[model samples]
Target chain A: MTAQPDQNTAKARTFISVDAMGGDQGPAAVVAGCLISAKANDEIAFILHGPEATLSPLVSKHPILAERTTIRDAVGIVTMEDKPSQVVRTGKDTSMWSAIESVRSGEASVAVSCGNTGALMALSMIRLRKLPGVNRPAIAVLYPSSNAQGFNVMLDVGADIRADADDLLRYALMGASYARNGLNVDTPRIGLLNVGTEEHKGRTELKEAYDLIRKQEQKAGFEFVGFVEGGDISGSKADVIVTDGFTGNIAIKTGEGTASLIGRRLKEAFKYSLLSQLASLLAYTSLMRLQKKIDPRRVNGGVFLGLNGTVVKSHGSADATGVSAAIKLAAQLVENGFNDKLAARVAAILPTEESPQE
Target chain B: MTAQPDQNTAKARTFISVDAMGGDQGPAAVVAGCLISAKANDEIAFILHGPEATLSPLVSKHPILAERTTIRDAVGIVTMEDKPSQVVRTGKDTSMWSAIESVRSGEASVAVSCGNTGALMALSMIRLRKLPGVNRPAIAVLYPSSNAQGFNVMLDVGADIRADADDLLRYALMGASYARNGLNVDTPRIGLLNVGTEEHKGRTELKEAYDLIRKQEQKAGFEFVGFVEGGDISGSKADVIVTDGFTGNIAIKTGEGTASLIGRRLKEAFKYSLLSQLASLLAYTSLMRLQKKIDPRRVNGGVFLGLNGTVVKSHGSADATGVSAAIKLAAQLVENGFNDKLAARVAAILPTEESPQE
Candidate 1:
């Protein structure tokens, strides 16, 4: 979809705040990604934060990017090695901090970063702060699945290592909002991640959260599908899978590792013999299609939800395609007004002071 | 490896008590698997438990199985739908109970069942009882990994939802012993499963478990590798990954689901066009090799460790191949005297009354 016409007259254009440094591929890839997003959507604009000298040459190479982007100079960079606590305390001048500042200052609709995950999360939480009644903010990611849209939303993927029942309930509401806005599902089916689907299984907090989520189905505008096992994460049964950050973090990584292992072995198999190499050539298109289906780079953004503003985190190792995907996700969330809708959803089902605790 | 030939000469053979019913594929598959194991290893014998009429026909069809197996009549069956508590309370006459009874009575070296996991675990714990100083028993399963043996041990797949620091320590000791016996790892590297390898990350218990497992490195005959993430589960970095049953169960299933999804997509890719189909034919051998590498059926059994006697739980949906794999694992455990070694290992590192609580 090209930039919407009305020449930016009917509606205000969305400006995405981007941290162009600290990624594995550096500012060049991030700048190229901004150009790609800008070329795709005319209504898109960028507030690029980085070492201005380095990013300026890259942005100037793409004339459209130079015209549509506003570069902000930042003296510091948050390396992947920097601890979250350390970054939060002393990373004030970092590009990551400046990127979040644009959102915090209401100069940008959303922020996209390919920095250290912990630092990005800590910085985002500290700057924008959690929404009212949000005890824990979660990172919601879309996973390739056999669903109608070929994706499922899973949340709490490493934001907080611990989550109580109330925290999990908020994840359900936030994840549902993400699925609805990000994935375009009208009424997402939300499932609590568990070892088993039976009501008697999993931790006590999960059962408590299960009951709480069930109570929110009508007002929350989603379907509560009960407990979903790990298999359901990729299966078509659930549109949104919610869990404590600890389990979600491990499960997502495990999925990634498993996919990579198989892909590596498949490559080895196709290169084993002369005839196999010939076969690989013949099956090139099909192989590319399969690769596209499973490539982690294609779906590269993890939305840090429950915060006052939206932040999309691309993988640090992401190339141009990955960065562009994160930007596209941020733009979509902005167009859908996801953060405000998520706040409303969370506020509706949030636990009251009089609610009993397990 | 063939069975030891001193069958009736130097020592009594290892007899694995088998539950001949309650599997998804019925008695035929279980009996066929027993026959395969007995034929491969003359030293392997079976105390097959099921209804006399049904199991006799299946067992008799395989002459070798009939010869090496001693039929034990069990009037009832513990189904997949049966609750663990219900089975333990009223399943005395079932094959699952009878199978575990053989181990408790010293009539069998170990128990192997292709039945309900929860029911099998419940029966095994009730009959064999927990080992001394063990707070909770864990189910250890070997996952396909890039390690030397192409497998790494992970526990508790679904024995208990909760694991305190002490329970995790026991899992480490037991898992290490299982790796030594099952995978023939000389000095298994025990890793505490967490969101990251960093010491300061994850929940309180994981950090506590990390400290506990570290202190047992020397006495437990294992190497402490500190914290490991989900990617390490499939990586060669750690030999035995320890976690609570809740996380382990979910991770294992997620891995299984992921592998299956990739496998299915690969098949689709190879059949997308006539050229790809011809390529599939030319690369058939390599594809088969790749398939075998990631096949869940090849790695079948989940060993319920930390009990007075050993019990191996096969996948309920296992075919003859899966059942044979489980039986082979049980035979290997018996041959290595794994249960005794595990008990001794736990008794050595188990926390005492004076240990400080977290």
Candidate 2:
């Protein structure tokens, strides 16, 4: 039967290792996120890696997934409470470890975790190693930018702290690749976060990086549209904005806070008494649509790039829906041959360049 | 005749030096903000510092405050477009510098600027110098916390970038003083920002700082309540949150972004169609009240404590209302004898056991 199928000349489906014990709500939320993800597409298969004692019974509850999902027993589970170095050291037998190993050994195309982030990243670096021609990798998530699609992708949310000029250029390249293939865009534009749009503004490092990004754009065939301030992080002014984890984290939090404060303020304003509640009923649909658009849960996951394998990390406080969306994304990224394509493209370009080699 | 009704004995009226050309809108907006602030109180005198060419006519427009507001001729205005260090180096006749000088020479108790911050700060540090026992001072802004009064305070928002363990302790001390004297709290609690709340969760520097803050709290008289995460920046968990300028800036931006995003989304959600516009009309009065409660303009200014002379920096984008509120705050800080009280408090206690000189 294998020979007969091989003769048909079609590609084999990609496999993903999912750490079911990784999220805030543990296996239940992860399983729910996975189920939602699995429901969206029928082509993807998952290897659930975790302690059999706790997870075997949990998976048994869903009869439909019995065939589509299989288990890889792991002795440990990385806890959110664990210290960074402590988790990295202790997670060898954990689900996160097994999942990363699967991707490394060619058994799985991608791995997904919503676990102790510092641990996941630490172990991931050791397990898969960085892609050739890349230094430190970055984690990027979708933020609601007031653009046509209602979101823009921002990188280096937490992965790399002290990124230099080369690292940023690489981020721009990877983000461009992701936007093109993953988001299905034809041309992706990159912007540098700054106090002002003038080329002369920003710190020395950013200025140097700006020049490098511009030079690379001139030759590397991506659009570099110049600098963007905090005000434009919300919209069509730019596509992929690059900044230090320090600023990126600040910007993200600021955006999140502003969204919450404004929402609460507006609610309090329109919600004086019983009549205002009635008024809300009339405007409820539009509100729901916008809420659906900006809800963090909907975009609750990020992709940690530059690792050897494709690993999707969900937000620490993600619920079932968020976890599910991450699962679907992990499945899609692996299915798209993310690593193979990115590696091929990088290898194709970097040999002639002066960058240090693997 | 020289005593002029014994001004010192007659309730010690406050004097404020206002940066007439600091903000984005310049003299007109500053003048407008002053009008509202002037309306709120009657015992304050404003020493407006800026180019006479631009400000003289603006002051003339408000003939009501010919006596209360006086225009001092300065050659230039500090432009946000200029580099902070460059402006400080080259612009002596600038409005920001003249305003700062006015404060230092005791012509004004407090200097309020909406000018280029780098220049403003440089001028303050160069002129007024530091308070005794303070290594470096920080700009502590009272942000909306989950307190009963709907406010909490954070420090070093954008004052200094490279804050060490001792600097943070100093910030905490000053913030505590501001809380006790300005906000009127009996015992204010302090928190240090880290990735996690656990004792062992921060970086080496943060851990080092954490230990010092704790040691100081126990050994000294300060109330040290443990570590806080980014989420705690909003909630009523701590009265004073201290972090480096980098983290503090991030926290502040995150808070601002969240508030603005919520407001934007609400407007879009509620005003989608003509009928929904009618809904907004029905709840207009309550919305107005909520706006008054949460608007940034109402809490326009932030005090730059720990200087020999009091200084406040309003947001560059601050409108007429924000400027007015800033002026009122400067007056209050001066009238309350901020410098004398802080100095006395610092002197009363032992060096390490001393009250924070906010």
| Models, CA RMSD each | 3.3, 4.3
**Could you tell me the interface RMSD of model 2?**
3.1
Q: Please, what are the lDDT tens digits per residue for candidate 1 over residues A60-135?
A: 8878777768888997999988999999999999999999999999989999999999999999999999999899
What's the CA error at residue A28 for candidate 2, in Å? 2.4
Docking quality band of candidate 2, CAPRI definitions: acceptable
Q: Per-residue lDDT for A26 in model 1?
A: 88
lDDT of 2 by residue, B1-358 (tens): 1212124534455678888896898788998887777677878777888878887777776655554677788978788877777876888888888898888788788989998876777778877998776677788887876566566678877677668877786777777777766676667888887655777655577777786677667433568877876666666678888877656765675466556665677678668888777777766676677778777777777677677988889989988888988887788777777777766554443455455433
What DockQ does each candidate score versus the true complex, computed on alpha carbons?
A: 0.77, 0.37
Docking class of 1: medium
Which residue runs does candidate 2 get wrong by more than 4 Å?
A1-12, A51-64, A87-89, A194-208, A225-232, A261-271, A344-358, B1-11, B51-57, B60-64, B133-135, B201-203, B218-221, B343-358
For model 1, the superposed segments whose C-alpha errors exceed 4 Å read: A1-12, A350-358, B1-11, B350-358
Best by lDDT: 1
Residue A9, candidate 1: Cα error in Å is: 7.7
- Indicate the residue-level lDDT of A338 in model 2: 72
By summed lDDT, the worst window of 10 consecutive residues in model 2 chain B runs over B1-10
Give the per-residue Cα lDDT of candidate 2 at B170: 72
Q: How many residue pairs of model 1 clash at the backbone?
A: 1
